[model samples]
Target chain A: MNKSIFYHAGCTVCVSAEHDIVKLVGSENVTIINIGEQKSKISEAENSGVVSVPALVRPNGNVLHINFGAAISDLK
Target chain B: MNKSIFYHAGCTVCVSAEHDIVKLVGSENVTIINIGEQKSKISEAENSGVVSVPALVRPNGNVLHINFGAAISDLK
Candidate 1:
């Protein structure tokens, strides 16, 4: 699947999270779009309908918002 | 305005971005929806049409997608 990940220091975890997925999809398969410190990304994010930072996207335009907490993963 | 943030390890940076906004809005004002490892969240994100993790959502149902790199911010 065509993929893209976004990350930044404002949210370091977001950066890391994006990295993990990027790794899973692999550099060749993923279209990495790093926002870094771009405020425009904020607007882009909004225009794209992203509620938060560090978003995982498929070319099909499907998206899932992620929140990492022990509640779900801790069980594992 | 009412606000929400969704994040996870699959995209940790998304998590952090959510946190920062959460802080800005304050716990009392925000409705924290922690997806953790619950697969349902993934579906929720899709149902919501997030198109990415760490989505910043307004009560109005508006969303923003974040990607970090600096191409946009670096200019600033």
Candidate 2:
């Protein structure tokens, strides 16, 4: 199975979003690229059209920007 | 005056912390090493004893972990 790419920046919101995405799609089904930890992934993330952290890139290369406000609210 | 090194990971909290620090200490008084933008700085950050992002390294080599909660709240 093709794994989706999850662009993370190691921020609170991104970490929370990761948990939600991983829960939505099994951990094994996604590959996390922490741009904050690995700068090399910044370009890759940009190439994938990620303008911000907590973004999801589907197998087919579709990028979805996660909403930090929504994610934070869900944490409560 | 020696410049303080600010270790950043390009995360929301770190970004906000940077602003506060820069405001507290003039930008010229600090040097920001964006670990998220430069992978090479990871080791440098670790050597400075930065356990997390938004850390400040004094000229004397002391590390201070900025409180993310405080930084975030201050953003409001």
Q: How high is the CA lDDT of each candidate model?
A: 0.46, 0.66
lDDT per residue as tens, model 2, B1-76: 4788887777777786677556545698789987776877777777777766677777766565653322321222
Error at B49, model 2, angstroms:
39
Q: Output the lDDT of residue B30, model 2.
A: 88
Off by over 4 Å in 2: A69-76, B1-76
Per residue, candidate 2 scores C-alpha lDDT tens digits across A20-53 of: 6565456987899877768776777787777766
Q: What is the lDDT of residue B33 in candidate 1?
A: 57
Top candidate on lDDT is 2
DockQ, every prediction: 0.03, 0.02
State in Å the error of residue A12, model 2.
Answer: 0.5
TM-score of 1: 0.39
How well does candidate 2 score on lDDT at residue B38?
80
